[model samples]
Target: MTLPEAPRGRPRDTRAHQAILTATAELVAEAGYAATSIGAVAARAGTGKDTIYRRWSGKAELVYEAVFTETESGPVPDTGSLTGDLTALVEALVQEFSAPAAAAALPGLLADFAANPGLRSRIRGHFLAPARTRLAEVFERAVRRGEADSAVPVDLVLDTLAGAVFFHVGLVGEPAGPRLAGQLAGLVGRGIEAR
Candidate 1:
């Protein structure tokens, strides 16, 4: 069933949106990205190809939304300490990346990110930018609390989290857990603490 046209964007059909997203994630995870095409996604979602195209510009856009927006969890955490916040954030990321579909989709997607600057930019804009901003805020609070040095670069925090998550889930194929996440958080905290 086609949704009645909306003025600015696709029809406000949440079910269709979610279905399309889930289908996209599943397809990419099941087949490589090269095999996950718009027509396939449309058929899998039981929606018209037009519906998928109406919402996203192309394959990268569709997959970016499916992987980032539809799956992101644990919104900006406020755990009082930088270590606590980082641990929570890292744990959430582990959960997100290690999910069945994401677990399957990520290895291929991560490879794509290395090769496609445009894909990286779109995903950074859609998801990572906000996450980085929240992390910056958490770092700021830590500095105020004397947990981190005032001079520590926020980039270090960002990179540390990224590295830890990727190293465990992407390279080693280990599920992310509180212990590992906590260790990473503690490492970031001590490494950047004011001398």
Candidate 2:
């Protein structure tokens, strides 16, 4: 039997989407989200405001998409061992926190979240939830493999790991590097390892 041909249409330009996101990140870093207008993003991106509005409804939606567009999803390494996986996971998290654009944008994001509960929820759903889901899968796999406590809540584990990294970066103003990752992995590994 012959397979059906694929549908024909103009493919979306991910490059343009990335340019807009990059512009948004830069603008938000220079000016807080409250001040970073869609017009500015359009200007920086070399795209029309209409194009941005076509993709997103308004400033909040655009900001949310821009922040989340920077994040990548699963395919989190298994590495055939819980310790290795956990270590890699921590390293990835630290790397993300240490990125210049991400680092610069975080303070403004926190401020925006504080000002608007509804916007905060939108961000949590779009950005935080996906990352948390990937991390939770790692924890769940460890639990199934008898490497971690089944009783421990996945949300708690995710919060602990992320909270530790963010605290170090945001509070101490230190680069969340391998050292921080190692420290976090050590603490989390001990908690998860079967006793």
The TM-score of predicted model 2 comes to: 0.80
TM-score of each: 0.77, 0.80
Q: Which candidate's TM-score is highest?
A: 2
Looking at model 2, residue 88 earns an lDDT score of 81
Off by over 4 Å in 2: 1-10, 29-35, 54-71
Of candidate 1, the 10-residue stretch with the lowest lDDT total is 67-76
Write model 2 residue lDDT over 1-195, tens digit each, in one string. 223453332233455677888898778767766678988998999888998988886776677556643545548768767777778877876766766655666766677668887776675466567777777777778888888888777777778887887788755678665477777787888887776
Runs with alpha carbons beyond 4 Å of true place in candidate 1:
1-13, 68-74, 121-127
RMSD of every candidate to native, in Å, equals 3.8, 4.2
lDDT of each: 0.76, 0.72
